[model samples]
Target: MRLILASTSPYRRELLARLDLPFETLSPQVDETAIPGEAPPETARRLAAAKAAAVARREPDAWVIGSDQVAELDGAALGKPGGREAAVGQLSAMSARAVRFATAVTLQRDEERFHALDSTLVRFRPLSLEEISRYVDAEKPFDCAGSFKSEGLGIALFDAIESRDPTALIGLPLIAVAGLLRKAGFALP
Candidate 1:
């Protein structure tokens, strides 16, 4: 069966490409609003599964992979910022703090589905207002959750990252997703 990715995120597209497996991409039209009282991890998983199922129903004979990420600090969920000011505020609040980024991945084929969710704990070094402002201005990672891009300039803001799968921090947990794909009968070298 052919494999399909249900997302338009550049980061997710890039991460998926690393597998060296050919796949098609499609946008999954689904509401991403979090349910009332829904936790960050749960939200990520739900969205991932929703995306996969949405695609699976359309391509019942093909494999579909869906993923989502959520960053949470102090129990408050942080999604992509709206603009420069919001990015600055989010980064400022995260400076010198530890944040949990949960990435969820789901694979579905017909009636069978497999999934995984991985959380990466990242500790940021004490950041000056000036530093935060410069990073935001230079990278404009406003579209990223928590207002930082660990794969880019945002790495300078971190003192350490504790994660079983570093790619999870990049937006997709490739290690776990690869396992799920293999179980779903995808050939991976």
Candidate 2:
């Protein structure tokens, strides 16, 4: 079966590649905007489905995988920082706090659909302004929600990570992805 990833994120691309499956990627070009009343998990779900549908429209015969991640702190959704100061602030606000990352994925082909949601809780260690500054300057994770990359230097900022699927924290839940793909008749050993 043909496989396609409906995203341009290098992180997601790398995570998907771990399956050792030949796949192609297309820029979903999805607007990552949250609705005023939508819950963080819901927003992730909506966006993931939208991404898959967008690409599925172009290649109806291919199995399209779409995924989205949203970070939630104290009941509010946190978006990508987009810059240095914003990243620092985000980290500061999250210091010694447990942040929830909702990663949602959807697989679509013709009329068949499969979906998965994984919520990972990351407890951040107490951080000083200097440490936050140093980390931000070194990693520059402005493009990631919650301003930290779990797979890289950002892991130093976390006291604990609680999740059924560790890869979900990085942006794609491979466990869930594998299950959904298997359900769709894709072979994996």
Candidate 3:
């Protein structure tokens, strides 16, 4: 069976590449707006499933993988900040607080499906106003959830991280994803 990744995120793409399995990437265009009364984790799961189903329809015989990440603090969703100002504001709002990043991954082929959600707790260090501004100015992580890229300088902003799968924080949850892929008949070296 062929392998497909239904996302265009560079971080997810890079993480998926670590399995050393050849796969194709496609952008699944699904409405990402959260349903009213849906929790953050459920929203991530729904979006991931929607994305996989959207791409799976295009390749009925291929194995498709879909994933999504949602960051929330105090029940408020923190989406991608479009620019520097928004990124700064997001960081400011999250400073010295605990934020949750829920990452969901799904694998599907034919009529079979497997899914998992990895929620990571990230605690940010108490950040000064100047420090937040400088970090946002230097990193420019406007497209990242929580307005910070843990793989980069953004690590300096977090005091601790609690997660079942570290890769989830990076956006893919590769351990769980790899297991799902194996179950779907993909061999990993």
Is 1 or 3 the stronger prediction by TM-score? 1
Write candidate 2's Cα lDDT for 66-174 as tens digits. 9999999988999999999999999999999999999999999987899999999999999999999999999999999999898999999999999999999999999
* Between candidates 1 and 2, the TM-score winner: 2
Can you write out model 1's per-residue Cα lDDT over 24-122, one digit (the tens) per residue? 998889799999899999999999999999999998888999999999999989999978999989888988899999999999988889999999999
Q: Over the stretch 89-158, how does candidate 3's per-residue lDDT look in tens digits?
A: 8888888899999999999886789998999999999998899999988989988988998999999999
Quote each prediction's TM-score. Answer: 0.98, 0.98, 0.97
Which candidate has the highest lDDT of all? Answer: 2
Instruction: Tell me how many clashing residue pairs each candidate has.
Output: 0, 0, 0
Candidate 2 TM-score over all chains jointly = 0.98
Alpha-carbon runs more than 4 Å astray in model 2: none
Candidate 2 Cα lDDT to native = 0.95
Pairwise lDDT winner, candidates 1 and 3: 1
Order by lDDT, highest first: 2, 1, 3
In angstroms, the error of model 3 at 30 is 0.9
